[model samples]
Target: MIKTIAAWIGSYADHPDPRSALAGKIALVVASNQPFYPLYLHWIVGTAAWPAWLSLLSTPFFLAVPALARRHSFAGRALLPLAGVGNTVFCVKLFGAASGVELFLLPCALLGTVLFRPDERLKSAIVAALPFIAYLFVDAHLGEPVMMTSDYARLVALNGMSVAALIALIGLLCSTQLATREVEIVTTEIPGARQHVDISD
Candidate 1:
């Protein structure tokens, strides 16, 4: 089954197929949200409303899929989610950890693993680490960790689910374009624009 899907996804090369790119981005969004599912459960049982910030980290990944599907900016698909991860790390300090804060590292690592090529992986590792590293510095400066207390069941469930999701994500990513080919991104101009003319002539 794995081999079949792997062949279907295609061999990696200097560039990604548009379909494979779309699948990769969608997979990212799916993998990114695994942490949030349990967090949402915590909110539902613990609060009257879902906190908007809980959705913060994965939103860009979700939003970027259409553009990626359309074969838009490679940087947008590849880099924007890193910003979201960084934002989430900072958010953990400002908010509380019960939103499955630590679990984000799983997705961040998984994201880097799939989105980056062999040559790019080192830089991708650094970029992926920067936010958490920055947060550590900020956290040390600020003081100790902030804990958000949740029910024992919720905590256990969140942790368990996070681990399972991480494993599944790793498995899924093994079939992605990164595993099959090198990538070369093509930049395309927007469909419409004003062209200059010598109207005075």
Candidate 2:
């Protein structure tokens, strides 16, 4: 099942540049995993409400990421972080400041850093900046939560765990991509260098 999902993500990562292709794959992975969040919140955590159900409305936008990547890698990369910002903001509004959903902005910012090519510094900066802007906006404007919870600590704890899990997942994927690129670079620059790589570690 994991191999199947990885292959599906790879199909959309056909950009000419390795970095861009990896960016698209990262977007695709995030897109594919999004639909499960509401489920986890509603069923597993039991902290979701009707407003939380509305969060699913954003799933289609995320699902469109691969198609966008197919047409324009940069657009797809841009969309993922932008959409994540919107989604996180909306969720924070739904659950309020105490729910800790706003913590997701960290990963959204991290995505923007790796999704764009090094030469596209301006675009990456703009994308990355949106989260901070949204964070401030959310902090200042959040008046009342759409869904109120009796146990603020539980919601905060749950969201903290969720955010931590997401960060770890994204970090692992980004690190794996970096490792693969290093190997590719070494082999390409020096023929037969691939044989020196140890696989039994």
Candidate 3:
């Protein structure tokens, strides 16, 4: 069953409608951002209903730890629900009106990369591309009506960039692992006679 799923994901490289794979990622980012925007608005306008301390402590642990653990399956699969719980706590506590959309991208991408086989390059490419697309739309929407302070906006952008970079890095590392695994598999399977194939030939 696992092998079958891996084979299907691997087949994505040959699929025609490449964009469909990225659709879910794009939707998640856009939808999450909508609610997050209003929260930022409240924070900027000084009408933020929630206290800063309530968010400051919990949000980081909830978002960061799972994100870190998500690079490996054993811990990551177990911790994802915990991460979701943290996200829920944050959403309820910080309830003003901002899209916490940015928060989910890294986690989703990390989860996709870790849970799926590394040979599914198409899926990995889609996962990597979605965050970049989401950022462009989010950046464009961050003007005028949703008036955030320049410093705050910069901070948010920087954080998003950092998370995106981290996701890409994780993807690259996973790809390397997959390549190494493939090479090991091939080397081990090579017949003794064929193994003597010379480079000069």
lDDT of 1 by residue, 1-201 (tens): 999855643332112444336435444555456466546654645542244345455555655554454454445445544654554565456335554555555555555555555676665677667556755664445443343444535654665586576557556655554443332121123222212212322
Clashes of each: 8, 0, 10
lDDT digits (tens) for residues 71-172 of candidate 2: 877887788788888988888878887777888899889887877777898867889899999998656596787887666777678778877877787778
lDDT of 3 by residue, 76-122 (tens): 33233344334433433343113333554555545544543445556
lDDT of 1 at 162: 60
Candidate 1 has a TM-score of 0.54
**Could you say which candidate leads in lDDT?**
2
TM-score, candidate 3, is 0.38
Better of 2 and 3 by TM-score: 2
Question: Of 1 and 3, which scores higher on lDDT?
Answer: 1
Q: Lowest-lDDT window of 10 residues in candidate 2?
A: 40-49
RMSD of each: 13.7, 3.2, 13.3
Q: Residue 41 lDDT in model 1?
A: 52
- Give the Å shift of residue 133 in candidate 1: 1.1
lDDT of each: 0.50, 0.75, 0.42
What would the TM-scores of all predictions be?
0.54, 0.82, 0.38
